[model samples]
Target: MSAGTIALTNNSATVSGTGTVFTTDLKANDFIVVIVGGVTYTLGVKATASATSLTLITPYGGPTATGNAWTAVPNATLVGITAQVAADVAKAIRGLNLDKANWQQVFSGTGTITVTLPDGSTYSGPAWNSLTTLLNNKAAKGANSDITSISGLTTALTIEQGGTGAKTAAAARAALGAFSTAGGAVSGSITAGAAAGIAVAAGENNRVEINNVTSGVGAGNPVGWTVYRWYTELAQTGIRRAGDTTIQSYFVALSGGGGWEFLRGGNATASGTWTSGSDIRHKFDIEKVKNALASVLTFNGSIYGKKDGGREVGLIAQDVERACKEAITYNGDRKFSDGTVIPNFKYLNTAGAAAAYHTEAIKTLFELVELALDKPDDARALIASIKEQSEVIKNTPIENEDPRKEAPPIFDVPSSEDYEEPTT
Candidate 1:
């Protein structure tokens, strides 16, 4: 026995041999992995040892049947190993190995797979491949292609049912139908107002003027009416368009006869049916009316014949008063022929300042009358004193030229002409 050789443990002894120093040969707790009689076993530490023989026990395994090796612990879960290999292969295909140098070394350097490429070159490691193939495989086709054609494309490129997706290239290339008519269209409804005939003649300045009227000559009847007639030569300001001109001036006088009529009445002057009493009410205040007319003495080339307002106002008042008085007569005791007591008639009651104006109109008339004809100052004074408020008084008589008197025609030619013999 070697002197230092000692028991390693309670179940173990260390021994030396003559030719071998066991201390140099033996190790503690190291399995002696050995094939014995074609059976493999992992021998535990020798509990006791003498020269060539030792005693040991196998803790993890006994041996294989024909066991050349212990079967590698059934390769430690074959399904799991297979799955790991498959995952590793997929990663390798996706170039995942490039992300890890260790994985690249594991696959590319000396290992189970000494993988060589088809080109007789070994795979060094992961290399980048083009995404073009993957892109092509996942690319979208148009409406005509199968469902899988759009599998991996963006949502904007694909369409589901009832989608209002924009037109495709082929669809846009298709022909469009023609428009219904040539130019752009318009909606219906449009036209004119009144008819043409019986429209008033132009240049009448849209009014009917009458002068030189024979009594009872109506406004529209005999083609020619009085000059200086009220509505004649009238102008309607700002009325444009032919139809507007006609209506503003001479509208067909509406009558109970259900036809067109004219203005004026029986035989007093060239007369038609005149407008109502109100229409000519200003005639009652004839002085004011005539003054207003005479205010615009000359209108568009026609003379007013009223040379002055103060004179014209007086003459017009006298004319109206004379006409009214001639129409009615009075008897003794100051009663009218119909036996009604006559009442004094006055225009624009002149009790105060009005009295002064009334006196002025009267004075103006007497002055005009004197101017028109030769009269004594006494006659003029007598006519001026005639109180318009009460009655007409006269001392020295006065006369006036009749407005109605007509002289013979200015140009006269004899019907027979004196003829000289024709001299060559």
Candidate 2:
């Protein structure tokens, strides 16, 4: 709305070109007259231009012919095309009306688009070229479907990849060392010729435990076989026998067969040329071997007791070996009777002291001294008491007894380490 004017004439004589021209600068709300073919009309000018040929526009809702409908000003915006322009024909012809789409219509694309309605909220859609319009139209209720808008999708999209769900949480836990099933098939590689010791619980299935156990490192894993094989080898080698090789391999093979062999090694009397190439027999089987060697070392002997000649052996007395063998036989050592190897000795020696003699008599003497020393009284007191008691019993007369019978004499007490046998 400003000041200026344009003149228009149908005849060439009145106007410069056959259009409108203005005689003077017209302020806003100015009016002009035009006569064409003897018909005079008044035109309300809304805007004026200063070009050689003036241009003017008619303001909206200014005036119109009595029978003709008013056309909207060119390029003019209206509020809520749906409600404002209720006529169907007017809305249909309107360009770029967003409500041209229904409530369920969704526009999707890239870039920016501004949507202006006649009277409703102002929204933005993408520009014509930058964005794509995805209009989702859903029915009343045949299926529950509605159009929803998704934002923040990038321009370049690859649809082939699917979501990898919950991977972050899976990576947070600790790893396990070994896995096995109670009864499932398993396979793995074992080193050849690597020795390993194995212990299988008794009463388990009596079958070959490991696969390919011969001559391989796996020979070490026969579940209680090492003792027999190792000792057999040591025994044969210690005696410098040719059978040592056979003994070693035999024990290795026999381990799975539940065989155990016990052997002792040391210099002994040569039995028949002391055959350097002969194999000696080990005294135990697998089961017994496990028990005996459970505590004894093949080379070192008993763990708790001293070496073979130590106190638990025959070191305490020179005659202990003879005594042990005799006692063993006297008690029917051939076969256990009442689970005893030797009969308990309790009687008199030839000198008639309350005594029991061992085949190795020194052992009996040591036992007697040990028993005496184990008593509460001092050694001197005990010895003195024994002497006094001996005299009393020796001198006392037996009532109603023949005087021709001689009294029994007490044998001299044996010393623990050094003792002299009484002379007749």
Which residue runs does candidate 2 get wrong by more than 4 Å? 1-114, 117-121, 126-424
Stretches > 4 Å off in candidate 1: 1-23, 37-39, 57-171, 174-424
Q: Give lDDT for model 2.
A: 0.32
lDDT of 2 by residue, 236-258 (tens): 11111123322222222232232
Candidate 1 has a TM-score of 0.15
lDDT of 1 at 334: 26
Model 1, span 258-316: residue lDDT tens: 22322122112212543434456465634432221221121122223421121112223
Task: Give each model's clash number.
Answer: 20, 30
Name the candidate that leads on lDDT. 1
Candidates in order, TM-scores: namely 0.15, 0.15
